[model samples]
Target: MFMTTDVTDLAAVRAEHVRHIATTLRDVRGPLIPILHAVQEDLGHVDQADVPVIADVLNLSVAEVHGVVTFYRDFRRAPGGRTTVRVCQAEACQAVGAEALGEHAKRRTGVGFGATTSDGAVTLDEVFCLGNCALGPAVQVGDRLHGRVTPARLDALLGEAR
Candidate 1:
């Protein structure tokens, strides 16, 4: 789940963490994405406090780091819940009622796409594809893939996740 900290504490910790991460990966060619990914992997999301530290270490502008973070859908700016629920929204899945399924998932989870539940139990996301086209309306819950997910099935999954 996204971490909640006092603003001052968060800034202090984020700077140290971001600096170490950037320093470790600075020698690599085009280390931007890898460094950001490392930060996200460690911290769950890339905090705004991280951007300036990362930029300074890499000798780049804060805008550059911010741009990359914003451009990548995989990079979360805020913390996600304990479980991530991704529903495929690709053309193949959509052809099989994925849209309806997506809506159902959102309503059932009480959050729209890219949102985590207040209880920090689940995060709902819309994905382009799960590479399970044959099984339309595919969904990936955490690391497990399931296909042909009906609204009832989605509810069951959410129940299980909770």
Candidate 2:
């Protein structure tokens, strides 16, 4: 089961973000992208309410704003479920079987890439790199990164989070 936030309040967040984005547009060339990124960074995700605000502020069609939002994988328009589990899927990690480790991690957490558990205790994320190539097959729980995460090791990692 999934629980989403109230859309009405999200609209308010978007409205304010739009105003800020408009200011950025005047100051920057491709204001919409940066503004959206900033909003996501500050708010964790972009709110739907801001689409109209962005469109109006950037002099873009609402559809255009929506397009840019969806185009980038980094931009999230909703909140993360709860605990974030980032599995390194970069080449360095994969060289040491990170792909298989990621698959196991997802199954162990009961959530796929970009998904959260029913209890909202965990959200699984796929990341390309953690700059810990030496520690291939790395995973980051919250902000702590772990290396050489085998299936057995995953249980230990999950234990720390729980």
Candidate 3:
């Protein structure tokens, strides 16, 4: 599900997002990382429909543009589901069994990074960090962050949302 969206032509929105991206990169020299972030934040996702527009706005080849978007872990070409569940996958979290946590989430949510539940109750993303390194295996559900997440702990955490 999208947030804070209003009626507006897709072309107009994409162009506006492009302008924002251009403006954001006006001071920076190379790389469109900043622009990409701005665009994603503004547009929710960089829909494939805007690829050409983004290329023109950033003066990048289509391949180059697509490559950058896909290469980065942060970019999303589609809107996130209702609940954005971000489980840390960084070294600190992984050291504390984040790998198992990820599997548990996949099995439980029936979706992985960039995926949403059928009813859109949740969206799961394997983020690299949540800045809670001391609380390894941390999982962020929407705005709330939790530490020491296990399958059972995650189950209880998710139950609260229902």
TM-scores of all predicted structures = 0.89, 0.76, 0.73
- By TM-score rank, best first, the candidates go 1, 2, 3
Candidates in order have lDDT scores of: 0.92, 0.80, 0.80
Candidate 2: residue 48 lDDT (0-100): 76
* TM-score for candidate 1: 0.89
Residue 74 in candidate 3, Cα distance off native in Å: 0.9
Model 3 — TM-score against the truth? 0.73
lDDT of 1 by residue, 84-133 (tens): 99999999999999999999998898899999999999999999988999
Q: Highest TM-score among the candidates is held by which one?
A: 1
Clashing pairs in 3: none
Candidate with top lDDT is 1
Q: What is the lDDT of residue 51 in candidate 1?
A: 90
Scored by lDDT, model 1 comes in at: 0.92
lDDT of 3 by residue, 1-162 (tens): 877655566577777768767666856876477777777777777777666776777677888888888998778888866667888889999999999998898888788776888876788888888999998899998889999887899988767654
Give candidate 2's error at residue 60 in angstroms: 1.6
* Position 70, candidate 2: lDDT: 94
